[model samples]
Target: MSENDETNLPVDAFEPNRERVKIDAGAFVQQGNTVYRIAQVLDFESIIGIAVETGRSTPLAVAELRPVATDKEPAAAPDLTEIADPDWREAERRFAAIQPLLGRYMVGRIEVAGRAKEIGVDTATLYRWLQRYRATESVVALIPKKRGWRTGQGRIPTFAEGVIDEVIRDFYLTAQRPSAQKAVIEVLRRCQQHGIDAPSPSTIRARLKAIPERERLRGRGYKEKAKNKFLPAAGNFPNADYPLAVVQIDHTPADIILVDDIHRKPIGRPWITLAIDVYSRMVVGYYLSFDAPSETSVAMCVAQAILPKEEWLLLHKVEAQWPVWGIPRMIHVDNGSDFRSDNFKQSCLAYGINLEFRPVKQPRYGGHIERALGSLLKEIHDLPGTTFSSIKDKEGYDPEKHATMTKTEFEEWLVALICKVYHERRHSTIGMSPLRKWEIGIFGNGEVQGVGLPQRPVDRLTVLLDFLPSFRRTIQTFGVTIEGMTYYAEALRPWINAEDKEAPGKKREFVFRRDPRDISAVWFRDPSLNQYFKIPFANQSLPAMSVWEYDQAKEKLRREGAKALNDVQILQAVTELRGKVEEATERTKKARRQAQRRREHEKNISPAAPILPVRSTPPTPSIASLGLLDIDTEDFGDIA
Candidate 1:
């Protein structure tokens, strides 16, 4: 390997003191990538509890997990020497001898991630070796072979014969078709053409029942038992009657590759994000992105799903796939790192939408997204288009000249087809097309009224005033100016003055109450009484503020901008209004005094001028004279 390659092998991340292992090889598990509870060195027999995977071709993506310590104790490592027996023969025999030792050293009772042949030497031989050759005084006796599943009797091509084999392939590919029965009929016709005596079309009807192979393995996954079957559930979703109460989101690497349009060379594989309604099984939002699965893509999927076509058009006029569906009350996703990121959580928080996370690596909780990915992977893999390279073909194949193709275009074509086929096509379980189910409002509650979605305006601007570049010198005045626009908030003003202006650094700004009527996610601006506060921008702006522009500025750069204006400008705006409150308050007091005097005068009693309250006085101090030192006279005589 090149030195560069060696450098990139996670050498910087590895710590010598800990067992910081990076597994180099493993089969793709159908969820987030890393297999949990993996043992560094595994020894096992017959790969017991070996989960049967259906689609090895369309592998599921697992999250890239970095185990973080939240006050978590370091993982106790298994002592390797405990299992390596010097006296034992055959690896299986050695394991049998050290069963008790392995049990004590290993954290868990069951060991996962083992090679099948390493331990399983035909169950009988393994057992014989375990007892006679490898058993130690302290080791527990090996349990002899339990009845095997007996599944290895036949091979794949022979075992999955008849409609069962045909069904597995056809069911997944054409599950979204309008008439799945017709699809099965087509398969039967193909079989007949192959010289097999095919059954009549009517006779094929009853045989169709045997096509559901997946149904047999239905309840094989983990499920939680009900704590109280009769009790009403808490945290019940909004609108029990709505069809779109829950939505699940997931991202999978699209089969399509992005290519440079100018030079049709593959740039990279893009991602396809899917948002599906849990109730109607409707594809609410579908987005194709060249970037990694980020909160931006996730939020876009949600916005595209929730906002109506007109609203989307008002915001993004040119896009053709703008969604016209309703908002999902609950957004469910696997506990992937991206989904748990602050960017994603902030979006959820801003929208007041509930974000639900499935347990780590649990695809079954987010089964809708998983199933959608399954369909997408197959569809894209099967899609055909002319492949191209850079605009200038390096390989010498040129069309008019050296013409090339991009995978992005192929992906776009696939996306369109899949959306039409998978989304518009009928679902097997729902017994209706996604559009049909969506329109009729058939969801978790069995109601006719569809889900009511939340409306998030695109115009809301989020900014932190404390960090604003123009924040200093701008103080609480009778009024304040932001971006050259002035606003009148009566409650705010008067925190700016000569004292504030001459003071070093930033002076306090005005305190403004938040208008309850405002829908934008904004808080009232209160000038810091030596404390911090943030204000909202005007709900809408002709030119939208790029959220990053302010955040990206360096402290020195922002302070330079802040230095442009001083507290003097704020004093000018608000000093005139300062006397208004005090003067008004005094005038009211004087008027009350005058009225009371006039009432006394009318009663034929000359009221003495009401004395203003007498000021408090200080007590007088006693006085005395003091003496002085006499050394200066003698020094004057010596000088003379």
Candidate 2:
């Protein structure tokens, strides 16, 4: 088939492909272990394909075919910065015109006609633009074709162009805004002094026209006006008409103290990272940990949000259903350093998620997540060992003495409260329960069609790996070393001491993904095979340990004035420290908490085994159990 025929295929043909896989007539797709070559795109729902090995025709649904990543596929996302300014602006304009239409599951013919009329375009043209935009989910896909001389490659002499640019920047774009004619005059005068032919006045005028309106206003000393025109309205909340359209995430310290597993004494309050869907006000994902808020907390929460929660719920032994799961279209967060990390930004970009930062000094931008967190804290205040909200509320109460729930037990109680209480209760703002609202959004009401469940990821591990922080290291004869840990696999043999392709004679740094919760193995992607291989620890006999524990061990050695610490010495120290913690678990709160944290980290890394036996209904603490109330009240019938 011709290349044009391949390029014109419907967007559905490319929906299930890898990040940079090209969707075309001859592209390869996989179904389980079978492979097929696309013969033709029959329709939006189905495709005609031929089995590669069997040489037989097969009709396949568009949803069944997954894009096969090969060496020919592009390795990175498109650099949108390469597009000319005019093209980028035009693409943005097109995107703004069609953004309202994108949230709908199905568009009626009348709706399309009305939008086309509003935009001054015909039906066919509008449909074509929509198709292009949907295929890539990027504004650059709508860029108009270049029909004239290439940008930045004009016929003007190099010196003349430089002079023009300098004059525009210094004179034309200053607070003392000069008239276009005067700017042109200045350019011509400069050219004359250099003894060069001056360009026409219209060329300079066109150049001035190309400057963006926002830049022009700021250049002319209208900073306040520019801000008013460009910034989003602070009072109104972000509009999210459908599920997964916008998700808000934030962090807060839990209001209740948790006890250690062995000693049953208070350790400290754990931090909570929460993600809520704006449309339904549902708590889609959360993370609880003793560590402070950081990139790992955000990553773990996002991973939980994207993957289904049935297994996680089961592992926690909570007999409740949590149906929320999907890749959100946009994630809204505050201007914290964790949210602004390069790793988080690149991961979201790779997964086609947009990251929006809260405006400086605008607290209302994140009000949704803040309010939800507040409600959860209120519920926590009712639990044993509660700190309440403030010192005034916590006065006369000793939370550490009353603390009774271990870390695992507290996790179970939190899950129960989220699924059974919070989700079931009606929300004042939404006028319905969160679970009900989520159901209506996903399954649809009578007025609109439901979008159904979001597409499940091809590989859950791959999705998690994408969101994880990465490190780069050069492979040596022994293997790759990271943070005093050495990992090795046969896959690194070919790349050992490989010279950098871009910089001759310099070593090339290969990328590796790791979970800080478990340092037993790291994931390495083989460039030649286009697949990931797990590189285990060089000393496989060493027990798995968290990065935090490793740091603690190293710090202990430093405190002892030990010099020249190596991997073996660090591991030995960790082993000895663990032994001390185990022995002191019965008496010291710190040791008990350390043991609990280690178990929690291990459970996160591998969740196949349940920590506690399955319970049909976990016991709830009562006022009488704390020696507060002994009298029982008779059951009262409903009063009029």
Candidate 3:
């Protein structure tokens, strides 16, 4: 075996003082190709118990194990080394005065005595100090020692401690509410019967107080109550000094009913993903979707926060300016799956953004974002289709009967209110409006300018495309098939049946990017030239529809007894369902609910989901396919 093999390596393979190679419990060690965590140190420096990934315990020799070192800083050594006992420093100081005389042997005891007198110490004490200082480099060695009985003062015998503990567990710590005085008497009786020394009542009382109240309560079978009563409240989260230092993201269901764009009927409440700058208390960006929170929703919300919104505001007809844009230093989030996803972590790492998760069950860490959501929802409670915030406030109020604004109208209204009203209103905490605070944070107090700077700008489309779901596919004779949809593009013709040179002996599989919102086309990157090409669906006659719409339509048809459903049949079903929802006059509750869901499904799908770099001229079927060229803008499809 090679020397790199951890299990086969000899004891001397590693250096004697390698800092990472620790033998303590809880340290990580590598054996062969597998890494094991040290569960316990069985013998001081000889044997240890290690737990594998599957939690199985295995015995390992200390010499055979090598500790694993990560990018984190090394474990700190004990801090007691620098400090010495009292009088150590004084003794060392006195010794320094007679050092020259002590070095000369010709100088007799009389000279040493004279030197000791000058330092205010007797000859014997001076010699003792010198002897201790020379033997042990630490000055602590010169201090007087606590000898004999002083070490055991006020201490109970081990056997007496055991007897007292037995009496306490059996009598004192029970649900019967036993008297402490009686428990102490019983402990004395038990110790006397066993011929062991009994602790005095005062000593017993002191020990009883030393036992934690929570532990006592738990011993009496009040575990939950004791925990609730004694557990400390979460500490306050420290505020950031500057804007964009830390941002928090959270999702809450909006407290209002929304209507369909076409039919003008009520749909369910939309989920709002809100991002806020903790320092300025300013709303950076938010996304409203009928779909539940997911990785896609998180990606879209982050993209909105990072990119410029001048064009988006104009399109939505909101006149207020929202200038916030930049990658935050760190993002604080809850332990939701969307926040924990690998995709989100990788994306944040790519932009040098740190991800911090709030401790589980600790709401104080995310109080800033939670309070922001609460305030926003409180404002929404006064709207036409308001749910009034809670069951108490919503009692006797019919939200659906009052519902009037469509999803699009609500979006426009929300943006305008956020920018024009909320941004201008004075915040109690900061003593200024969020917009004003942001201005001060970005600009200055008056004289000296702030040190804050905007992050490097990146292409908005590039970020959007990079976040989309990627799939692996081989360039087969039948073009590329994704989710049962075959896509074809003339640019793929030259690379057909090509083998991937990077992975020898493995079938060549290229990565394809897709936006689940619109299944009309997918983007493929040519590995050799490092350029992306869009390939539309094989059939040109099919109507453009969101993935949710198509899936819902297919499921509805299947429930209606249709078999062997095809894309054409599914499209026909979608059209039929849309018409029924729009024209129905007296519908059942179920049908109305289905119609609302359909409306939400369609409304959330954006027409601009995939924002890949576009080109005007097609590839010339020459070296141009392998060469690089600047990209131009082109619209792909709607975002689902």
**Could you tell me the lDDT of residue 286 within candidate 2?**
90
Error of 1 at 597 (Å): 83
RMSD from true fold, candidate 1 = 34.7
lDDT winner: 2
Task: Give the better candidate number (1 or 2) by TM-score.
Answer: 2
Off by over 4 Å in 1: 1-241, 310-323, 384-415, 442-640
Better of 1 and 2 by lDDT: 2
- Sort all candidates by TM-score, best to worst: 2, 3, 1
lDDT for each candidate structure? 0.36, 0.70, 0.61
Q: Candidate 3 residues 424-449, lDDT tens each?
A: 89988778998888877765577634
Tell me how far the alpha carbon of residue 417 in candidate 1 is from the true structure, in angstroms, after superposition.
Answer: 2.7
Per-prediction TM-score = 0.34, 0.68, 0.55
- Give the top-scoring candidate (TM-score): 2
RMSD to true structure for each model, in Å: 34.7, 15.6, 24.3
- Residue 616 accuracy (lDDT) in model 3: 12
Residue 638's lDDT within candidate 2 is 7
